[model samples]
Target: MQDMSASLEQSKPADSPRDGHLKRTLENRHIQLISIGGAIGTGLFMGSGKVIALSGTSILLVYAILGFFVFFVMRAMGELLLSDLRFKSFADIVAHYLGPRAGFVLSWSYWLSWSVAVVGDVVVVAGFFQYWYADVPAWIPAFLTLFVLLGLNMLAVRIFGEVEFWFGIIKIVAIVLLIITAAVMIATAYVSPNGVVASLANVVAPGAVLPHGISGFFAGFQIAVFSFAGTELIGTTAAEAKNPHRSLPKAINTIPLRILLFYILALVCIISVVSWAEVPANRSPFVELFLLAGFPAAAGMLNFVVLTSAASSANSGVYSGCRMLFGLAERRNAPAIFARLSALSVPVYSLLFSGVCMLTGLTLLFIIPEVMTVFTLISTISAILVIFTWSMILAAYLAYRKRNPAAHQASTFKLPGGVPMAVTSLVFLGFVLVLLALEPDTRMALCVMPLWFVFLLLAYRRRTA
Candidate 1:
């Protein structure tokens, strides 16, 4: 009512050196779509079937719980970024609140997480290619997708924003259609191929919520965390966003409802249209629903949608990954050459370095055909690293509360639940780590995580030397 956004844009601190440095070309719509694109991923499109099979109706509860914590994480992130627009990436804020050592660790770990995530996306992209041209080499689409996304990213930040804007729209349209089609089926009493009625009653059926007991429900965390991995991408865009003070809060605020609508509602439709018992964990339930309803065209459409989903994620990986590398170099944690910017104000060298990683991802697919399967292991590892990143964010927030009490009192954006949410979120992240260790396949990631810290420490010491 009092024109909060206008006030935010004008409410710069006395020492606002962060302003006017990076090109703030991203508008509110760009930031909003970026947030949406981050929240939805190949995990939801492909991995939901696995989670549904594992947790059944309780999967709804799983998403709700994780989504709540994610909101708090973003809230903490938004508060930190708004407090100082100079902070470019999460690493910047980590250094400010934590220390240079923590910054070095978080920065590289985040870059590693996205780099591996791009490999996983490339593998998925190649698999999507087989959906049509099985004869073509997997490396073709994998490298080709990376090339196109890299070209677009290197042009300008706005070009990347435009690509993601359309990508997010594609995802939104597909999910909205699913919810509508499923609702119509339920109203018409259309039955699924499995003889299940198109009704909400199926949610409570197939063993009543905890289909495989609480263990199975907890097992949902493995894939669920992967699904939610990129939700923090918005935080990386603070330095590029035209109105970080206004757009940042709006993007972070809408996460909870988007999770409910996109995840909880979409899954409810999937189970109601077909029994969760029948959904396969290995593939997307979206395609299965269409094929069950006798619509190969729709299945194919959903496949294309997911194909774009993988590309969208890869696009984000390059964007966020390059930004992290740039941040690290600027802080002298890495070689200073990566800190140089091109005429477009883009970090060209860092972007190309990440492109090399994407290229290797494609090469791995050809060299070791089994590498595609191992992509799941890589995805698990990415999830663990991202969890560590998010935990640091929450920990940074807690530190901010303690160290800057006056700033917190006078801040325009305030994270609710304060110390409680920070403590609970940290504990929940630890529980997810333990859950990862309990599972045989995912345990490797938790094991490899310590080695990553060791590498970062060694790299940090070498850089300082």
Candidate 2:
């Protein structure tokens, strides 16, 4: 809808803070696809199974509700970033508006959150690869993917964007094909060998929309919210984006449509092809659809799509984590080494640090394979941190509006509901925290969250002292 190049030219500030020597090599195409890559990942592809198993057909409404509300979160982030081109990273906006203390805690929380997710993704990359070659050492592929992403990121920001762009294309194409194919089959009253008909009737007749009832609907939030965790990634790219004003709003606007097509429509198709009750917990519903339709080749191709999906997530984490560190050092909240960039304008040390953290995931294959679930627990904890980070942005927006009423009034890129939207989004986030507490499995992360804050408080004091 927006003319990207024209908007980019219109929005570029004459001068802003130097990005620690970082380059704005990311083009419009790169940002668009990177935005897509951020929104689609293993959360939807792999974790959707758990959401389907727990939520039943109600996963549709769950994703839609989550998606619709979070757009305000993105909009607030977009307006704040557009208001100040000198700031880099979403965390910087918090620091600028809310004081350095809030910035210090959230910046670290976000970095740790994405770093934890990358560890999980690297483990997953290995697991996905093992499906093709069970004989190979699992850690080998995980380490390979970790190092490869590290290499790509080290070269330049655009290279990382380019790689992620293609990875996003693979995932997009796969979801589109699945949606179209399933629609045709459902229209024809086509039946699989298992005798499951692809029909909208499959959605309701089983047990109404909420098959498992209210508790089941609540159960889906734990995993489904995690599925939405990566959607805020555009915030991290704000500093490096060629044109923050045009690009940020354009990308933010697509969030609703992405939720509809990728999560809602695809899940709709999956349930229609295979009853929610029939969906297996151990395997991806996407693969199950093709295999049931007697298309092993299609199923196999989907496997690779999931593999690349995991890799793309890790790649994004690497990019964002380095930026977080860069933001921290720029604020003098992190060590000076992290703020330094290389000749290619890349945050070399910060990226290597994150890549090293991700490579540690390999130790799971050797030292403690049995307790590998630890990574998953850490990831849930990371999800909690991510939720806090988003909440911080919303909270900062409320502050920004009150503190700078004239700026808020003058901005053309407005948040639709203004302060009310931000307030409601915070309340909804609080409700999600309540949902996390209700589930025993996720309760641990909720309990552990406070400890992270305690550590952050001490760290902040030490840094400031």
lDDT of 2 by residue, 1-465 (tens): 133233233322223233445666677778888888888876787777777887889888888888888888888988888876765667877876787799989998898888888877777777667767978876788778888888888887888888988999999999999998888889888888878877988888758477778887887776677677778888888777887777888888988889888999999899998889888764578878888878899888888898899899889988899888877776677777777788788878888887777667557668645223544465577668877988999999998897787778878888999999999999998888788887676888889789889999999999879
lDDT, candidates in the order shown: 0.83, 0.80
TM-score, one value per model:
0.93, 0.92
Of candidate 1, the 10-residue stretch with the lowest lDDT total is 11-20
Lowest summed lDDT window (length 10), candidate 2? 1-10
Which regions of candidate 2 deviate over 4 angstroms? Answer: 1-19, 135-137, 365-376
Local accuracy of candidate 1 as per-residue lDDT tens digits, 29-108:
99999999988987788778878888888999989998988899889888888876767777787877787789889998
lDDT of 1: 0.83
